[model samples]
Target chain A: MVKLRARCLLLGDAAVGKSALCHMFHSDGTLFQKNYSMTTGVGLLMKCVNVPETNDSVELYIIDSAGKETLVEACEKMWGQPSLLCLVFDLTSEQSFASCSHWMERVHAHCEGLHVPGVLVGNKSDLSARREVQGSVAQEWAESQGLEYHETSAKEMENCDAPLLGLARAFHSLYQERRETIQNLSPG
Target chain B: MIDSSLTSLGAKVVVATSSDENHPPENIIDGNTTTFWMSTGMFPQEFIICFAEPTMISAVTVDSFNVKHLKIEKNTSQNASNFAFVGEKELEHTDGHIQTNAVSLNGSSATHLRFIITSGYDHFVSVHRVSVQN
Candidate 1:
């Protein structure tokens, strides 16, 4: 069986359910924090995702950073060359959703111009009554950024695994593509 | 052009009998001779490399330190079991330098390759890299 490891960076504005989504997925949906605690530094959580229909697995090191503007600079230094990204946004907040490009630019700078495969996560889907970001708009923006879009509700543990699972599958496909290039090499 | 073409194109070491946090098993296929995976200290150490798919492998070259004997086996199944013997090599120890040896696999097709280290020149052995020719 093949096992791989990848660094997945979680990005978003504060109170966008970044930590909640991370913790919910890490705990396998058993725990969701009812009380809020501000994250000052980077919080790391790891979970192994078994790719469906394959013996392969990917161990994702999810780097959950503090989203406050004052804390973002300090958090930026801790995100080192992430191979995958989980860009989160609050579904009820247009400002948070608009800030996605800024967060992605920071990631682009930190990655030294390498294209990182990732997902744009619209969190807080359970709060449909307060939603401000339209699904079509989010999907269009995600397509423009070369990212797959996923809507999730960390509070209700709805579709929490889909984003990470998609990342694992994407990484697996990258390895497969690399192998195909080698297979094309004629024996010397 | 076929010199270590396997890892240069992209194949990864998925399993190792010994892995250091700093020197992971993945480093063995990273195409760097300076970085290596060291055994914790024992005989009968092994590691499995899984390819993207079943590949036609003709040969492989191993770069290492303190290794005495090496055995290779391959399997075409998706699972890493039921491997057949491909070949074996008795490596000569190089003092402080790396030992580079190449073994032919008789053009076998496999999805997984298993390398078994039955004995070593020292308690701890480090495999620097493995390059395959198909």
Candidate 2:
């Protein structure tokens, strides 16, 4: 059985459903709209996900960080630990989408030298009518960055598992390539 | 809802109350913040400050008292200063009795306006009272 550890950082403006997504993805499958106080500091949770393809059981450390000046510092603290980063943005607001640029820059600065897989998530996809961003615009941005994009409705569990599953596959592919490169270098 | 008061220093002070304390939001560090956004009104174009600090000096305060204040401009982010202090002289007069400090903004003009509390404590610097001086 393969065991992997990954940390997913949720970066976005205040009230962008970062915490809500964390709750939804966890094993509980519960929904909370109780208006959790804005995360002043980092809020963390851990869940073990079982991948059937590789028979791998991976533990995901999810960080729902507060959107404040401390964000830069926190990102630096968890810089090397994250294997996958999700830059979450709200669908209803254009400014929230714009703010994702800052988050991307901060993540890039901290993850220096390492190419971590990233996904751009347009949250609140359930609210299509109120959505200020077009999927194609987000897709174009993601394409330029060479990152995958997904519009998810954590509220309804739509496209929620796609990124996590995709990340697992990407990790497996990288591992296979590394194994092949190591074999090629072996004397045998 | 606009105030008619006009002061020489700052425009009419704008203050609003929290909708409900029953639901205060938490931040990253577990620090709590209550949101209070006052509607625009007839106020001088200056920094409208808001603060939240303990009401006492006690044994904790040494160099400065914890005074959370902010300078807000129209259609812009508020510049916040946390864990600040009023001048020693101001604290000396108020004697930590800040509950009666009147929480007032200057009525006339100025470059840098400071709030000085001598003594006593109020435990909160809410956006309650607002006025302007001529």
Candidate 3:
């Protein structure tokens, strides 16, 4: 069994369900209103995901960084990880969607030229009538920035896992291509 | 100005708030010789408190709002207050309004009992009276 290591960062505005989304994916249940700091520092967790197609497993280091300004030091730590970065925005809050550009800019500034795969996720899609950002709008914005986008409702578990799975597939394909190129260039 | 009718001691109190960078007056804590008064508007979980006494017990007198609980902490030496769990008994619940159980400091009076708002509604703990009987 192939054991791969990956990391994922969840970044967004405060109270955009980043923590809730993480809990849903990790624990597969709804947690009650518990102690929530404004994400003071980075909240870290680790999970192992079994790839159904390859029958391999990958251990993911999940980093949920603080959205509050007081925790800039914590958010700075995520800059060096070459894992997949996910930008979560609240569909019902237009301000959150508009703030996506700022978040993306921060990632770009920190990651620099690293090939960090990203996903633009518009959460709270279940509340369509109250949506501040339409699906097409987010998709267009993500496409323009060379990032993949998906609308998911963590509350409803809608399209919640697709973005991560898609990124894993892309990462695996890229790894394979790199290995093939190196093999062909070997003198032996 | 000190109110001698209740109790008298000197210490510090910490009040936490969740206001954004552009927002001011997040919370207020004015310390007196014997007690500290506070007004907070953030959610209950967002507030925190720390005390200045060593091996000392601290009690929070919550008024004007209903709290699920108030987290308490003690110190052997001066350091950050660790999370301590405390339960509440209904002091008064009438006409859709509620109050908290009065916390007591076991007859042993001290200079400091930090009032941190760990979680609950938005209100002020006016502290109408306090006495260090011990």
Candidate 4:
């Protein structure tokens, strides 16, 4: 059994339901709240995900951070070196979706050249009537950025675990690739 | 390729140069990168990993932050002393991220593997995880 841990960064524009998504996933859909005061700093939550058909498990240390630009800069120091990224956006708001690139840029600048396994989360999926970003568009954009796509609704507690689970799986597989390289060392 | 890490095989970190309440040397073998063993604040920090039994290793991958130079030594003896130099590497510096590097061990059998950090990119360095391949 291989137990790996990854620091997962929860990022996006302000009021993108990042906190709600994090809480829903962390509490396993039992902690959804009607009101959440603005998050000013980084909130940490950890969850262990077991990969199917393997004894390997990954511990995801989710850093749910403030989405405002001002708060984001202050929280950056506390984020440490995030190995996984969960970029969130409000599906009903096109402006929030547009800011995904900016958030990705911040991560790139902070982590330098390290490859962060990531997923683009389109939250608030239940509000289909007011949706501003199409699924196909977001999927295409995520693919271009080397990130997987996930749609979720924290209010309804729908598909909230997909993004984090995807990240955990991705991190586990990344370690697997590295293990293969090490195992294929040819006794040199 | 091996599917599981040495953690499942019952490896332990027996000795370390420095230890903090939040960051202990044991974190190095936990197979979790988010939890790490951090150096208090200086150079020449080292640690010894003791395996459940003498195992043959071909390479080791280290995930660390701010570590500049590293030397790996191994020994098959019951004690931690009298370790032979297996290999050394100079790691690249990464900003706000762990520097992952895999070092070839040349298929040495050992009960204990000692990693000595001679220098660092910053004042304090942290070793997140170390995975060995046999």
Candidate 5:
């Protein structure tokens, strides 16, 4: 079995449930904290995902960074060339959805124009009553940014693993593609 | 007395809780903001800077990233122990740029200055430079 490691950066506006999603994914839904202190910098969490129907696994080093504007600069310094991006936003808050563009721009700038595989996650799906961002609108935006879209409720522990699992699979595919390219270069 | 960079006057990082080969503790006093000392994903990380002699420090400026609560301590002893509380500051967050925070030491004389990063906004914090004025 091939084992790969990828740095996955989790970013969003403050109090948008980035930490909750990360914790739920890391602990396999066994743990969830209701009260959370605001993240000041980047919080590192790691989990290994087995790619379905393949003898490969990818260990995702999830960097859950602070989403506060004041801390973005400090958080960016530690981002250190992420292999995947998980741009999270609150489904109930239209402002959080609006900020996704700014977050994308910052990530792209940090990546130095490289194409970093990513997904746009609209969290807090359980709060459908207060939902301000429609799924279709978010999906269209995700398409425009070349990202897959997923909606999850970290509080309800629903579909919390799909986004990260998708990231692992995407990274594994990229690795496979690169390997194929190298093999094609062989003279034999 | 003339204000000078502590690193130019032989200030050395004697103790650090964590170290990285690419971003070493020495980078804190190297007088270069581009090169930095990065912590290895833990809380309450600290480093001690020892001066060649007991010098009166007027103020200190630290250029860092993601640091939250910073505590400063000092000592006049030749050894690297017995520290007295100097000061503390909660760094303000900045976006897209390193935080350049100036801390006043109130003209305290010390042979060793300890910088304890009690907390940070991120899991890992990077201190780019620490300059002292006399």
Candidate 6:
């Protein structure tokens, strides 16, 4: 059994339910705060996910950062190097969806041209009547960016764990691939 | 009348709640914003700095990251204990660069200064440097 650790960065626009989604995932749907003060900096949360039909597990160190433009610089300094990304946006707000591009650019810049495994999360799915970003559009954009797309309603605790679980599996597979390459390098 | 980094004037870190080998407690008074002391994690983390002698301090400049609330205390005694609350500030959050904030100390005299990071924007907080103005 292999135990791995990965730093997962959570980025999104303000009031897009980034914090809500993190809290839901961390608490296993047991806790969800209705009133959230804007996250001033980065909020750190951790959870371990087990890979199905395997003894391996990945511990995700989730760095939930403030989405406010004013605090982005400060948050970036603490981001260090992330192994995975969870780019969230509110389904109800088109502006929030539009800001995903900027967030992606920022993350890419931070990675220094290295590919980081990630997913695009369209949160607040419960507010379907107010939705401004269609699911098909988000899915297409995610595919274009080489990312998987998932819809979640953190308030309703629906599909809150899938994205993170997917991240853990992705990280585990990357680890396995690296191990295989190193093994191949060794002489018999 | 001269402002100086406390470490240059013989300040020593007496105690730190948590420490990391890569980011030690001594980095706080090292006078360099690039080098820093990072908290391992958790709230109400603190550190104590003892000066060579009791000196009058007008203000303190802190270069840090992820710090949300800071509470400062001081003592004139020689030992590490006996602290009196001096001041507190709710730090403003910043992105990318360090949060350089000058907190006025009301010209208080002290031999020891205690900085308690009561809370932070993240689980980990970094103190780049701490300087004092006389």
lDDT of 6 at A113: 52
Off by over 4 Å in 4: A186-188, B1-134
Candidate 1 per-residue lDDT, tens place, A141-169, comes to 99999899999998898999999888888
Better of 2 and 5 by TM-score: 5
Model 3: residues >4 Å from true position, as ranges? Answer: A29-37, A186-188, B1-134
Query: Which residue pairs clash within candidate 1?
Result: none
* lDDT of each candidate versus the true structure: 0.83, 0.49, 0.54, 0.83, 0.83, 0.83
lDDT tens digits, residue span B1-134, model 2: 11331132222223322121221211101111122111111111122223222112111111212123233222112333332332232332222222112223223223222232221112122222222222
Residue A40 alpha-carbon offset, candidate 1, angstroms: 1.0
Clashes of each: 0, 33, 5, 0, 6, 6
Worst 10 residues of 2 chain B by lDDT: B24-33
Candidate 3 residue A70 C-alpha distance from true site, Å: 3.9
DockQ-wise, the better of 1 and 2 is 1
- Chain A TM-scores, candidates in order: 0.95, 0.85, 0.85, 0.96, 0.96, 0.96
What is candidate 6's local distance difference test score? 0.83
Q: State which candidate has the highest DockQ.
A: 4
DockQ of candidate 3 (2 decimals)? 0.01
The weakest ten consecutive residues by lDDT in model 6 chain A span: A179-188
Error of 5 at A50 (Å): 0.7
In model 3 chain B, which range of ten residues has the least summed lDDT?
B19-28
- lDDT of model 3, residue A114: 51
Off by over 4 Å in 2: A69-75, A78-80, A186-188, B1-134
Candidate 3 RMSD to the real structure: 21.5
Q: Write the per-residue lDDT of candidate 5 for residues B5-122, one digit (tens) a residue.
A: 5678888999988654556788888887777776654457899999999989988888887788999999999999999998899998665577888889999899999999987665
Residue A67 in candidate 1, Cα distance off native in Å: 0.9
As for DockQ, the candidate ahead, 2 or 4, is 4
Each candidate's fnat = 0.00, 0.00, 0.00, 0.00, 0.00, 0.00
